[model samples]
Target: MRVKDKIHKLKILRVKAAKAMHADLQHELNAMHVYCHLRGFIGDRDALAFARKWERNIIYSHIIYRSINRSSNA
Candidate 1:
């Protein structure tokens, strides 16, 4: 494949990955909000910890998205 085609494919893949990441983050945030609201009622510390972990995952996904964007632009 030509360099241009490879680059284009990479760009498309990057965009799809970014979109999926954003969707995942949004879903996580929504779940987080629900968990926060029910935190007192649930009384399960483990669930809260899981939510926090998901939040961290969302952050990591954002970092990956930015890194891919920067590298692609360069």
Candidate 2:
């Protein structure tokens, strides 16, 4: 294939990979939220906030998880 065609194919593949990763992350966040809510570690409002903020920052995600775990343990 020509160089231009190869570049186009790479771009398409990258887009598809990004979309798949996004879907996986969203699924993970949803599962975490549901688990926390069902286990009574957090209420509905806080679970929604956790799911929303989890996507924005990894450090914040860890903090939230630790807090929830600590609260549950206590």
Candidate 3:
């Protein structure tokens, strides 16, 4: 799915979580983090691809942050 779509869905999920009496706030917070990370990923993906093609110029791509992608990687 697209990053925007994922972000929209996460936002909706957060709203639902907020309305739930037994919802864990941490879960909503984590979802928001993921949503932001996806946005960053969408932003940085282009630059990262360019950097990787040019002999690994960038030491780090904060857009494709490790903390964000770790779960997907696992």
Candidate 4:
């Protein structure tokens, strides 16, 4: 592709990165709600496991999003 096309594509990627970050944040928030609900219903060990799983998901998404943002900025 041409240089201009590459730049344009990068811009689109940046926008997509931002959108993905937002979506992940929303998903994480929803997971938090579920975690809270589960805390009341499930045993402590089960609740803790679910919380850890969701936390890892959120962390992974944020890491990916941050890496993409940083690369796009560079």
Candidate 5:
């Protein structure tokens, strides 16, 4: 896997990343709507796991940044 492919797996996307930012969640979830689409089914679920983990990290950082701005203003 290339350094960039690990992020969003655009190779599977139909429109590519140039359009808009959506599906910022698990690729499996985006594909079929399940948080752990391959948690146990696949012995090595690293790719799906990586996508979900990064999605969560991005969400967490956004929340934390907003909280910081709100606190600093108050």
Candidate 6:
């Protein structure tokens, strides 16, 4: 395949991977919230908020890693 076609396919794959990551994160956060609620350790809203903060950190790191990789490749 041509370089351009390969780059296009890679971009598509990246998007799909990002969407899958987001869905997986959401499911995990929901489960965490439920577990915390059942254990009476934290309120539902608080648990979700905590999970979301963790999620943001993960996403931010992923973005930084991607930028670093792009720069190094270029």
Identify the leading candidate in terms of TM-score: 1
- Assess candidate 2 and give its TM-score to the true structure: 0.30
Model 3 lowest lDDT segment of ten: 54-63
Q: Top lDDT: which candidate number? A: 1
Clashes per candidate (backbone, < 3 Å): 0, 0, 0, 0, 0, 0
Give the per-residue lDDT digits (tens) of candidate 3, residues 23-50. Answer: 4445545555464565564366653343
Q: State the C-alpha lDDT per candidate.
A: 0.56, 0.49, 0.46, 0.55, 0.44, 0.52
Quote the lDDT for 25 in model 2: 51
| Weakest lDDT window of 10 consecutive positions for candidate 4 | 6-15
Q: List the residue pairs that clash in candidate 6.
A: none
Candidate 2, residues 1-74: lDDT per residue as tens digits? Answer: 44345335434533443345324555655555564455454544644464445435543444566687789999
What would the TM-scores of all predictions be? 0.51, 0.30, 0.34, 0.46, 0.43, 0.43
Whose lDDT is higher: candidate 1's or candidate 6's? 1
Poorly placed runs, candidate 2 (over 4 Å): 22-74
The collision pairs in model 1 are none
Candidate 5 C-alpha lDDT tens digits along 1-74: 54355334433332232122343434523542232343332333665556555445555655666687789999
**Model with the higher lDDT, candidate 2 or 4:** 4
Assess candidate 1 and give its TM-score to the true structure: 0.51
lDDT, candidate 4, 10-43, per-residue tens: 3453345345666656665565556445435245
lDDT (Cα, 0-100) at 68 in candidate 2: 79
